[model samples]
Target: MKILFVNTHYFLPQSRGGMANTLDQLCRGLADRGHTPGVLCAFLGSRDMFGLATRARIKVAAMATGIGAAHDAALSYPVWRAWHPVDVLPALAGREQPDIIVAMGGKVVQVIDAARQTGIPLLTQVHDVEFDWHGGDFAHIADVPVVANSQFTADAYRTAFGVDAQVIYPFMPLDQYRTDTHRRVVTFVNPLLRKGFRLGVEIAALCPELPFHFVGAIPDVDETGRELDRGMLALPNLTVEPFRGDMRDVYAQTRVLLAPSQWNEAYGRVINEAQVSGIPVLASTRGGIPEAAQDGGILLPADAPAERWATALRRMWNDETLYADLCAKAVHSASRPQLQAETQLDQHECALEAAINDHRAAHLSGCQLPA
Candidate 1:
């Protein structure tokens, strides 16, 4: 089946963000399974949207690869952005002839337009429950197939809108995260306040001897990045680094993955990614984190004080036996059969197939899909 993904996020289809990485892996993974997958996105990315050098790089890639030269490049590996995707979706779908369209990025408006314009089957992955019916996004999604990234997110939807969403853990290849580099730095990925930057700062403040590296999801070179990063910079023990396309370099130095998310994360991809390297995670028991962290995680209450977080950090830093056990558990947690990319990809495939068939039936008969 040909699957075209519609992700409107500025960082997506190229993977400068975590969700984009998930979608990119999903596309390539589908191709490996003898199905074609493609991405359709917006051009106005936050940065480097039309930087001459960036545009040159994209143009060169298009020239070099042309189309279908590589595996499922049959979709031409489209690097496009639409101001109004609803206007462009039909023409693109007509050319791509995608068997179905999946929307993983946080845009239901476009997917709804797609159903009306092209009659293509629609499947949405609830990357986060960050938005709501009042957000003007969920109000129209009563019939769309929802695949939540975690059980907690599915449960939230069930409680809020009575929608029974399917759960498909984000697809990640555990073997790829194994790093031979020395692991020593205490690491935190994406230090936004909602992601609990303040809590991370407090922990860093309490543990002055431990080195904490805050990994940014985007380039923190901008004024906004600098301004938001002031708290972590105030501490001598902490260091902030901006996002680069590849994360293995950051993972290379990470002795412990610190994820103190203040908000309900739909899924904490970093927790799982860290475990793949046998690195223990000190994360908040919030949202889907526990699902990803399992026994490998040294979980704490999201509302835990800075003292508690610092104490845990100190323990992880000083207790060799505990650390070693967590390391083994981390590896085991990551290696679990259910967390494998192929495993989740298979589930995603089944979900997509069912969604397509179900959409066909619903549109033809005007009946609601069974819960």
Candidate 2:
């Protein structure tokens, strides 16, 4: 089926975060399976394109859909509505004539209206706790189906909105993330406060001998590589790197993966991404880390002190036996049957087909689906 996926966040080649990478894999996987999948995103947004860096991002969005679909924020809106994305998704949908619309984030209400206006099947994807800013407003879009990134995310929405979302882990092409070189750096995928950046920094500082790599996942890294430029880190052991479209570049040098998440993550895709390369993860127990880490890695409290993280890092660095065990477990966990790329793609196809059929049935009966 021809499916049009909508996400407000940056798609691949814009942001190399785990979500973006996996979504790219998802689209590519679908395309490989004889399905045409396109994506619509805010793409550096409609407002504040004045900076040279912002304009560069706009240019980089050339392959917006990554599947040869037209993508551009609507430009007809007044200046006051600049904060909002250019709202032309419905018109785009009308022209693309997709059998299904799977909207991810940003102004999802707009996506809902687009689906309703275009009379297309809509499936909203919940990637995390903050899937929608207007979470309570889900009652309005009760008829729509949901595809969650993990069971934790699905359960959260289920408890809050009485929505039974189908859980489909994001697809990660493990082979793409594998690397030959394993550097000594302990890597953190995205270094932000919410992602436990403070803890990661503290741990690095505490362990003077251990080197840490902080990979920025932001679109432009605020143009000047914000994390590295600050010069705030007294310890020279930590290196802040800019976002990379190809994570193998980062993983190639990464010995251990760190996810000191302060916020409750929906599903830590990066752990599995790193694990596929036989890299063990040391993460927090805030949300889906346990689920994602499974038997592969170590988990500390989100509020664990810097000393605890440093100790863990030191042990992982010094103890070959423990490290080897965790590394083997990481590989085994990543190689699980359900975690395979083909499996993920199959799940996505099945979910989309089911959602599409449900919408068609509802429309044929001339009835709004029961919540």
Candidate 3:
């Protein structure tokens, strides 16, 4: 099937975040499976919308009007700016008629007009609570199936939009995260001290004997990243490194992955990545994190004192056999191979197939909204 997978902008659909990486992997996987998958994104900031990566899987094009700033708050009036998938219609003229169009978020608005014009089915991948938070008007933008990356997101859609959404957890390329053995380091990625570390530092301070390493920066958001750095400057046990995509080696040196996120995470990629890398996790029970943790590690309750985290860490360190057991479970939970693709070609094959199927069957037979 010929598929057109669109993002509001090019930043996503890259290796940076789970949402974009999921699409990138899926699109490439679909292409390998013999489907023609093309990408339509906006030319934003300094990115090459028509860069080689986007060019390789399918035909890539950038529209003059781009969507919201990549990490902006929520769906606001000018958040998307003039971004709309409608403009890409001219570039897509006479292109192989797409059987499906799969989009992740408000970016779906960009392609709704084109899908209506062509009668192609549309499928939306909801990665967060935005659709539900914004209400039903957003539902009209797509006449296709909606798939959320986690139950949290799916439930939000049902409650907010009165539309039932299917659960399709985002796929990670596990091969990149595969590890040989569990290590002794305790690690955190994209460490923002303000978000959760007031407690994390207290925990680390309580257990001065253990090693705590913070990896990754604020990512697309510069101010938050800098603020996190400023907060961490005084701490000696907490070593902060700029963001690095592949943390398998880092995980190899660490026995536990700590996610003390204070946000309402729809689902966290770090939890999965750390698990795949064979690191037991110790995290705060916030948002969809418990879902991501599954039964893999210890979940500290929201209001649990930082000293509780310290106690858990000390227990894991002393009980070698218990820590080993947790490591084994983490590997098992994250080792699902059907999701990961080694080569770019294999990644697109799987992504395109799912995107195409979603486009075709996502909506009710007559294209009516749920009653």
- Flag clash pairs in model 2: none
For all predicted structures, in order, the TM-scores are 0.84, 0.84, 0.73
Candidate 2, 129: how far from true, in Å? 0.7
Query: Once superposed on the true structure, which residue ranges of model 3 sit more than 4 Å away at CA?
Result: 9-15, 42-44, 47-96, 106-115, 132-136, 141-143, 192-202, 219-231, 335-371
lDDT of 2 at 76: 16
User: Tens-digit lDDT track for model 3 on 111-156?
Assistant: 5555567656666667776444322465676345677777887887
Q: How accurate is candidate 3 locally (lDDT)?
A: 0.62
Considering lDDT, which of the candidate structures 2 and 3 is the better prediction for this target? 2
For candidate 2, give the lDDT.
0.74
lDDT of 1 at 93: 75
> Per-residue lDDT for 18 in model 2?
68
Please list the Cα RMSD from the true structure of every candidate, rounded to 1 decimal place: 5.5, 6.4, 7.7
**Shift of residue 315 alpha carbon in model 1, Å:** 0.5
**Quick one: best lDDT, which candidate?**
1
Give the runs in model 1 whose Cα sits over 4 Å from its true position. Answer: 12-15, 45-76, 133-139, 217-234, 363-371
Could you give the candidate ranking by lDDT, starting with the highest? 1, 2, 3
